[model samples]
Target: MEIFMETPTAANGGNPGKKKRSWKKLLLWLFLLILLFSLVFHFTSSLLFRKTEAGHLKFITPTVAQFRHEIAVRGDISSSENQDIKCRVRSTGGVMITWVVDEGTEVKEGDTIAVLDNSTLIDSLDAQQIKVAQSEAEVKAAENNLLTAKIAKEEYENGSYKVNLQKLVSAQIKAKEERDRLAEYLQHSKILYEKGFVTQSQLEADIFSLKQAELTLRAAELDIYVLKEYTHNKQTNNYESDIKTADANLSSKKSVHLQNETKLKDIQQQIEYCTVKSPSDGKVLYVNETNRFGSSEFLVCQGAMVRERQTFLRLPNSNKLQVTADIHEGKISYVKVGQSVQVHTDATGDKIIQGTVIKVDENPQPTNHWMGNVKEYRVTIRLENPEGVLPGMTAETKILVEESQDEKLMIPTHSVFEHGGKYYCIEKKPDGTLTPITVELGHSNDKMVIVTSGGLTEKTQLVAAAFENRELISLPELAAGETSSPTIRPKNEEISGDFNGENSNSSSPQAGMKPDGEMGSDGPKFGAGEMGQNTGMPGEIPAGMNGMRPGGPRPGGLRPGGMRPGGPRPEMDKMEQNGEMSAGMGENGFPPGMDGMTPDGPKPGMGMRPGRPRP
Candidate 1:
């Protein structure tokens, strides 16, 4: 096979146009490389720096040194005591509203607000007055008639005595005459029968005449007695009946008089109310049945039909404006008398007004359809300065119930950790170690917390959060048991024991054995003048105990000892005086009287009774 050599074309090499095209392609590739590098850098940085931890992270600070209580502003408004005013009476009469005062007019006590057309009422009142007059006259006439009837009854009772006496006297005289005639006739008839001058029939007739005379006399006497009894009983009863009739007439007249008086008073009051006077010193608010007044005029216009007792116009005291804010039932507890408040009127950048809660209504306001589904209490706040504020102005208010100062020490609530049912703060050690410290806390306003105890002084540095992606060390595991040492590391160079700076490895001294073989003294045994350098017994007795020996058993039987007579045994004593023995030769080798001695009693040579023999 034969190979042919190819020549370089203008587009591939030395030609200017071909060189520019090649350079353009190279520039484009360089740009693409740069874009790719930027993309890789952005992706890697985002992945590395993203916040992926679940717990909250915050800068550690003493709760007492940061955060301030925020203050709130309150608002006030005015509302009508009478929400709705309706016509109280139905009438089509021409209601002429009399203008007692014009708009923007200031009225005083008893000033007239307006007068409705009172012609109808006046006419009715006049008619009532005439009827009252007529009733009064009739009552007077009835009273006079009752008086006349009482006089006539008294006269009739007095005349009854005379008529009864005359009847009784006449009946007695007639009865006596008839009895005498009957006796005379009976004697004559007997004489005639003895002489035989008369016939038997005549004698019988005479006897019959005597018997009739007797009967007549008896009848006359009975008539007199009956007349006297009837006069005494029936006449007295008639007098009593007449007196009762007089009383009934008097009562009837009195009742009529009372009714007339009551009607008169009522009519007078209705006439006075017709004038439509202002109840307070205020500007006339408006006229009913017409809107021509500028919210300050009270007038009764012609052809306006007004009813009885209708509110023709309103008079509101605009100078002293009050606000009634509806506090929701849930927040009513926070709203009390004398709480500080600020009021803002509308959204109009107006100056905020200050006020105090004056009164809180005990009962909540009745809910209505207009009010959303919420219970509210009407709280009245009296504004101190109500110069420019008008009634019915919309306002927004915020009540400030609580507040605090700034720069108060505050810590993030979550930074505090709990373990073993105790609160602790995680503090970082110089060697990068972490440990927990118990702390007492104080007032916390939800967002921040306060540490009240546990040696947490102001500005002490603490761990705000646990190390990222690092596991927390458990305190229980580190401590091992309840008697284990504390984790505090002292800064002093002299402290050279366990974490609690206690000698954990040293063996306890044997019973009755001091560091020195013999009892050197009642104090620490050291070379002469070496007290400061030696780690002597922490609470050792003074030297030269004289008759007593060091590390010896107490005079009291097997009693643990301390500086105070009855105090707890020194912790160091347990380690230093272990297995010590008693020196006295009593029972159980205890000192004499030791069996009766209490644990708190002084030992034999404990300076009691200075001259006594030492144990």
Candidate 2:
């Protein structure tokens, strides 16, 4: 009984020592694991960040320097004072070409330079003459009608009434005579009755004859009264109306004749205008214009249909020369009137001509396809000495836009970027932390920009471009591949799933997937077919195929296991089975026979080997 009690006590003491030794061993292992992990991380980081152009962020040290700016513009020599000769004729009938002076003929004032066919105007003139003759005959007929009416009116007023009164007087005389004779005969008959020498019936007949003569006399006298009252008014009114009508007709006929005569005069004037004459004296230069297709054709020719008014001759004054420069719209703001300009021409042995900007067009010049849609303004430069410059010759002009020798702190234009309507730059400190810096920009040329205000010095270093900020080592570099591998997690640690089906709990069989889950990073998509992501074979909601999840756990209808409930997961890592690889994830890594393959990159025969993945 005494030995059993002592044994229990000794065993209990040995248990404490074992527990202490086991705790020590656990601590040593944990320490070793932590130290190994730290060493591996450092090594990998150092190896990955080799001094590549990409890895080495571009940093430029600003310097105090001077910047001079200029713009190059193309121009052509032209005359400041020019004269144009145009056709001048007013003819309804079109003008036909007869003869024209040859191009470049020296002309003086009043010298005939062209002529037109006058046959059409001549025919019109002959017709107008016939119309004038007809109008004159109508005028003569109207005058004769006026004379006849006047004569009739005069005869009724002067002679006809007097002659009727005389006839009535003579009838009265005849009646008195007849009455006397009858009275005498009746007296004689009464005497004869006493003596039975005459019969009573004969004396009665003589008295009746005398009475009829008296009635005839009375009627003739009444005719005189009727002519004085009713006949006078009626005849006068008719004569007056006839005379007025004749006058109006004669006026109308005369007007028609005058109009025809005026027309004939105009036609004659147009005929005289058929002969062209020079208004001024100058050297003539022929003009051949370029059409829309850039093909040159003669617009002014002998047989060409010349319009009523068209400029066909030009006289350019080359003595006082000038150049017309097309300044690009972007640089036009720098140019101003009265600014000095330098012009050079190939015809003048490239001699520089000093000039001044005489005018700057307000509106932009019209654009053509051949001009690349570049907007430009027409700037006229008046040259001081043209030397041997001629019209139509090409010239190059350099306008002094801006110049500075004040020693401004300038950097390359590519070094700065604007954000949120403010210019910004990335400044790198000695500790390798990129700090955002705000800067104000000033005048700039094609290459350099002036930094007006910023906390920058001559020795300050800044990123050359915005893309240099992304050149840093990112978390993607830590995972360093397109394919994902299964990594078991500790019991205490939990993973989260991303929208792209990456980084899930270790308990889940399909945990991590490829970043940006397409088919491959450097390989084909889905397969050689390059199938569309949305239509992965119709109504079958393929989980891992098209990222379509219908009554499924994740996208592409992938179950907790894989494409098939308990099959290989549809991930990049399982793309290859033994040595066979999916069509999308080619065994050689590249799509077969890719036409877009570049010479510097993978060629046609490049892909993965047996055990190694594609390099």
* Residue range 1-615, candidate 2, lDDT tens digits: 455544435656646677689999999999999999999998887656633433477788776887666556788777888877666666564566677778757788888877877888889889988987888888899889888888877887677756765776776677667767766776777787778766778767766766776676577667666766777778789888988888888898889888988988888887887887777786665555666456664466677555567666677777887888877554577789888887888776747888899999998777654654346789999999987777778888877766785898887766665432356666777876666677887776555677889878888888776434534423222111122122222112234444343233232233333233332221112221112323344324333343222222222222231232322245534545543443333333434444344454433332444333232
RMSD of 1: 27.3
My TM-score estimates for the predictions, one after another, are 0.41, 0.49
Clashes of 2: 9
Candidate 2's C-alpha runs over 4 A off are 1-72, 75-83, 90-97, 133-214, 285-298, 315-326, 344-355, 365-376, 380-395, 403-615
Error of 2 at 321 (Å): 6.2
Tell me the deviation in Å of residue 326 in model 1.
Answer: 4.1
**Error at 456, model 1, angstroms:** 32
